[model samples]
Target chain A: MAVLPNAGADALLMTPTPLADWLVVAPAVLPLLVGAFLIIVRKRLHWQAPVAITTLALVSLASIALLARVWSEGTLVMTMGRWLPPFGISFTVDLLGALFAVANSLIALGCAISASRRVIRSSRRYGYFAFLVLTAAGVNGTFTTGDIFNMYVWFEVFLISSFGLLVVGSTRAQLDGTMKYGVLNLIGTTLFLIATGLLYGIVGTLNMADIMRKLPLIEAAPLMTLATLYLLAFGMKAAAFPVHAWLPASYHTPENATSAYFGGVLTKVGVYALFRVLVMMFPVQLLELQTVVAWVAGSTMMLGALGALAQNDLRRMVGFQVILGVGVMMAGLAIGSAPGLAGGIFYALHSMVAISAAYLLVGVIERRSGSASLNALGGLWKDVPLLGAIAFVLVLSLGGLPPGSGLWPKVMLVQAALEAGRGWLTAAVLVSSLLSVIALGRFFLLTFWRPSSTESRSKHDGTPRVLGVLTVVAIVMGLYPEPFVAAAVRASDGLLDPAAYINAVFGEQG
Target chain B: MKTLIFRTVAPYLTALMLLFSVFILLRGHNEPGGGFIGGLIAASAFAIYGIAFGVPATRRAMWFHPIAIAGTGLLIAALSGLTGLFSGTPLLTGVWTKSPIIGFDISNVIIFDIGVYLVVAGAVSSIALALESTEDNH
Candidate 1:
């Protein structure tokens, strides 16, 4: 309960009483079990769409409650079966898990709702729903799992489900996308498995808490060796620079709704896992190995923006730009200082919402206009004021313009980089943001600013509900980032102190 | 003549293999076999069935595509883990209380194993079926 009272859990264990700690666990998992049941049962029900939608709405509610609990309290951990630390599997809730679960699930529900009516139009719609839930479940598992091996397993669960979703329709393009997605990620998975095995061999335990506790005692060489493998694996998953071939290869393959879900949740899992393992378990090297990370992140951000600029396809351009955001966010972690980590965390939450909104707008734009290619598309700003407004908000936020949530994170990261005396990072952020603006703005201007040509596909407006969902998220998050900021700070605190995590697993800090 | 006989029994054999896969999943936590191996075994059975009966029949018998089954399996396994999160236990925490009833042994953590069983079985067979279909098309 509340990080085991920050004392010896032995004192806390004598009571075995329920607290807010138990509350956090329910939200992380409850709706998934219920959702699965509802989905399957809905198969037999007459009104399957409503049933599935309502179930996800319930899940969204559960995540909101959890975020509230985690925000009010710092972090929550539950030891299974009344067992003390070091003996039983522990499930933990920190700011990172809480924020991601709430925001991602909400966005997930929005994405699901946006496409629910149309999904069943496909014969494989049930499979798609199943994949969606599995993907969400895998992401939840990835964020909440406290064991290192379990995290690897969860990543596979997410990846495999995503692979299926990518090839849901099995067209030639889908196969090409799935092949790229599956092979690159498979390599990442292989490295992760080998690294996990090596870490387990060195540490004698796979539980993250056990490892974090024992890390201070072990030889550093093996740790660093495994860390490099892990960083590469996770970096590839996050689509950081050169290793990001798979992302652009497949990010545009799936239907827009599917792409929206991927945009909203999948890559963010890589980001969350990187933060969880690198920050939570490997603080010593995180500080020492900061340079390699910072440079990699800087390069990833710049390259991603450049890649986006080269794309003429709306979805592909957004996909490339999403990679740039990954580097910027990870750079915050590379800083390893408090402000930097918080900035990174804040940036992650901000980008997930901003990117999801952008993807949703793109989908609706294409749905109404009949093509997502910039070369074949022309302005709808004249005809569709609503889409234009959504585009304005999304682009402004993506470019990290002021008065948007993006600006706050960029500001925080700049400060963190400056504090770390990597003054070049401040300049890097400026240059990267400037490039991102140009990259993003050019697409927007060409698509929305200019008038539609004679052969242009007619622009269709997004449903009120779809536009309403993302608009509310963008506005609320942009206007009030305090809650998100607080969650990030708490999550940062939870990660920095390995004592609670270590004690929960090993029964003692020593 | 021999090939005809193998073809004739293959469909039934697929059923038997799936049942055996269930056996492995049930016994896995206490023994050497579990979902992954069991699922693979079941998949191979389907592959054998696919060879005998053709890809379409095999997929038709299974009811969904190979990838869909894998996706569903993953979803089920993940859901089983999520059960702990909702119940106020830790995520992925296996919760079971063993009770001895003169001759009966049952713990619903066994149900969790069944979910894993389905996942593994579904994933392996579907992959087998999908590969078969791709080959057939060529």
Candidate 2:
């Protein structure tokens, strides 16, 4: 391995070996390569599904390996183009990032499986699989990149591919949905770019680790303005309060598989960016803003849950729950303690699986009954007992019930808030949980328990098999949360102390 | 629906614009004119032809789906990054190979630029064509 001596030299600095760092790049690159390949053979409809599934499976395997490597090695950093840290693009993955990437890959795999048949039959003209893989690549890049500007680039990549996916079939409803989704998201990304420009102007660097090192030397006033700008930009992306109107209006109208993918993976990337930038980069600098964030967190939870309670459409109801999940994660960040950070990480992992599974199950029901409206849906329990049982578990987990994945994270958050002496946040979490129970429970009874007007058997599909696997994962994680809890604690430690991350990226000079 | 002026000038204009696009793409490594601008320029040429001669003629001229071109371009860009991996450098690290006989420098950067050029051209053209076809149907 050739080590370039000069810090900002243009010479290529080779690592000891390339294969050692392959996992860091593989998760992002594999999907991109696969997507390009799928596009080349677009006319061969028979090859699309198998190729997509295989590619996603490989990506998932790579993501898991990356997580394992990060778990053992602490933060892993790789600089692109062999340039030094502040001058070139770099990707650094901590345990939190690795965990999120793994979850993202799994959710994408689930969506791919769910879309296999539908894409082949109805979406042959739209290049559905290519956009799906491109979205995965974008999400992976967002999770793993260590540069702020690079994160913005990945956000655009995600947004563009998602725009394609949103209106692939070009139905009237889908086109309307795409218009709202596209315009609002474009506004959000533009804000994000503006915030990036401001941050660069202030710090003169966009490398995240470098910015963390330089931020403290700068004045606090301008930094607060940047923080507010970030909150607004990422808030729109996460669909947080005051700017969450686009999510429910558009998310419910996409195809079931696409909806499931967006529900599980898309907003979480925004939340991930928020957690990464706000909590990790400016923990001490943003103390005054944390209180405002706490209020926003509480309102987000309350409003999202309340909105869910008012919806009769199943996908729309779950769309609000996605907002609720974002609020829960925000509460963890607001508390700003190690325990709170851990709780947030845990809840993010839990919700990614549970939310997507819930959407997939609803998609199956919709496929069978030809409607996702709760008022028109009934007696599904008798029609498909297996799906009913899976839906019950998913709904329970979503509502934060005991013996479910959601409950553990809520408990952790409540305890953290109590320890941090944030009694209002504790109250917010409990109240939101109560509201969620009412909302999801009402959905449960309406969709499954009540007698139906017709008793015909619904058509079966592959959604259940994929969703069933996800349900088992959620159940297992709930029953034995020791490993996941430990990982969350470790990830929170990384977030709370940026020194390890800084040193890894900048070497001893940091 | 043909415009006499556009139809008379379209073929020569398209050929010149495409040549200019390649020149821009080649100079992109060291100059401001790169794949994105080059691709857009080429797509404009196609748009002119489409408007003058209609979509069917434009489609015939393309001879391949613009989306496929975009996808192929993406693959080329991604594969160019792998050259760095094979040379034991970080991803997307430019590996230069100077040719003795030609006294010229070659690098993966140029390959990546070409990839970017194709992707931009393909994406823009596909969107333009789709809109035009839909309008034709209506």
Candidate 3:
């Protein structure tokens, strides 16, 4: 656990410390400490939810503060052991990372609140809160770390916690889901490890900024191989085409809140890594593989939407839509242009909030109507008008309809593709959006508009309040997108140009 | 497995191994032995004791759930890294003593290693005990 580099007393006296430095590591460290604490206090059912919620709320605040600092001051670097960059394990938060961290923490906070109902006493005894906080720590660590190997470590941390959460109830379906999820994800991480090892061997450093500075001096052939390996690995993690089976298969087996958390945060980590490594470290190689990636993006989008259209289970439909979202982001990466990357990042932020809310709404529907299958559910709009309105808002955002968070990014992506003269990619985006609308629209109409298929039992629930807030946030983002758009454009600029990132690590010292 | 002769010897063997594991864990700062290997040795000792006696006896002997031990160890490990903060250094920085205390080097580094030792031993013992109990049931 102690990855501290060698140092004497003299090294500590050189650099003056600041409050912002502590804030940079707060998102990762606070959750880990609180998670361990939760494990110790797992028996106190009353304490677990409150502690976890408070910690996540604190994490959200810290991440927002860090984001503000990074937005204004470029990148914030906090080197462990007081060692300088390239030697120490640096927690570097650039604008892209900071933005994602803010979103990650807020979504995690929402998920934790939802888990209050979703996680039962039996599951709580199994350390659900511990695993949840630890997963957040892993995601935050992945976002903040500048070292490539450290990112792999964070992946393991989260994946292990996810495994625990997946099999919390020891149900047969969950066990089967975990088996598939574990095997495929392990393969992906192994590939990532192999790629990291090779990149380290070639560049002689694992620090991303250092790699960026060194990769230009290396031969192009090996770099191309590395880029392809990364694409395959992160693509699998992001649940992109041909490697996305694990997501749809395993996601629906877990508890609804757990599923919501997974939907919100997990694949986006892969997308973030792709942005950091491909766009930042291997831009030339990424460009070389643009056509291949565009093909993958187009197919992933179409197949995911088509798969969603074929699903009757509500969460499973959203599961496929998760894949569809990944394909949209990949389209941005494949476009390899400024607007394209911005659109992808913006869409990612939008989806993290929208999709999580969608899953939570599904949970509420399941709890109220006692069914997750669309065929067995009907007339929610008449019975629960408020929930139907929330669902409508989520559908609008998720389907990229007007006046929702999801539309602006799709427009930017389509416009970027058109501007780049990729008419086929443009058509793919439009066609997939149309298909997604049909798929989700059918779900909304059947579940909300059609006559009741069965007697409904309504109960007092807290989920709508949570769902209402998220939908409102999504609506506000749609109604007022200027700030979000500016952040995305600036974040994409940081990715395309890493001079600020590099200097923040190498130059921000005594 | 619980034959009289084996059970008679098991207690002595387990005690010696536990003692040796402590020795290994203590000398890990500048030597070949460390928390991970030391923890493995200690866990094997517990596993032998569990095999000789029943899992219930072993659980009574430990007197704490292995997972709780592991969690405590994790908390200790995370907290140990904060020692650097007092000295105005970044987290996880090794804060060493100016001189050996009682002819032994004492630092947060050793505390961190001991935390690792507790985690490994606790986690391994739990897994082994669970497997043993399952076998007994079968």
Number of backbone collisions per candidate, in order? Answer: 3, 0, 0
Task: Judging by TM-score, tell me the better candidate of 1 and 2.
Answer: 2
In model 3, the runs with Cα more than 4 Å from the true position are: A1-13, A508-510, B99-101
CA shift of A214, model 3, Å: 0.8
By lDDT: ranked, best first: 3, 2, 1
Model 3 pairs whose backbones collide: none
> What is candidate 3's lDDT per residue for B17-64, written digit by digit as tens?
999999999888788898888889988998999999989999899898
Classified by CAPRI criteria, candidate 3 counts as medium
Q: Chain A TM-score for each candidate, in the given order?
A: 0.91, 0.96, 0.97
TM-scores of all models?
A: 0.87, 0.96, 0.97
| Clashes by residue pair, model 2 | none
Candidate 3 C-alpha lDDT tens digits along A1-510: 223335564443347566557888899999999998998888999899999999999999999999988888788888886766687888899988998999989988988888886688999999998999999999999999999999999999899898988889889999999999999999999999999999988989888889888899887448899999999999999999999989988999998889988998899999999999999999999989999999999999999899999999999999988999999999999998999999999999999999999999999999889898988999899888989988998999999998888999999999999999999999999999999999999999999999997777776676467778889999988989999999999999999999988888888441
What level of docking quality does candidate 1 show?
A: acceptable
Give the number of the best model, judged by lDDT: 3
What RMSD, rounded to one decimal, does every model reach?
4.8, 2.2, 2.4
Q: Where does candidate 2 chain A have its weakest 10-residue lDDT segment? A: A1-10
lDDT of each: 0.73, 0.87, 0.90
The collision pairs in model 1 are A86-A505, A368-A460, B66-B126
| Model 2, span A1-510: residue lDDT tens | 322334433343434435778788788889999989999898888788788889999999999999999988889988888887787798988888899889999899989888886764557556788888889999999999999999999899889889988888888988999999999999998999998999999899999999999888877448887888888889899998888888988998877889889988899898899889998777775577888889888999998899999999999999999999999999998998999989998998998899888888888888888888987999888888888889888888999986779989999999999999999999999999899999999998988888986765577655478889889988887888989999999999998899998988987656
Q: Output the worst ten-in-a-row residue range by lDDT, candidate 3 chain A.
A: A1-10
DockQ of each: 0.23, 0.57, 0.51
Q: Model 1, A266: alpha-carbon shift in Å?
A: 1.9
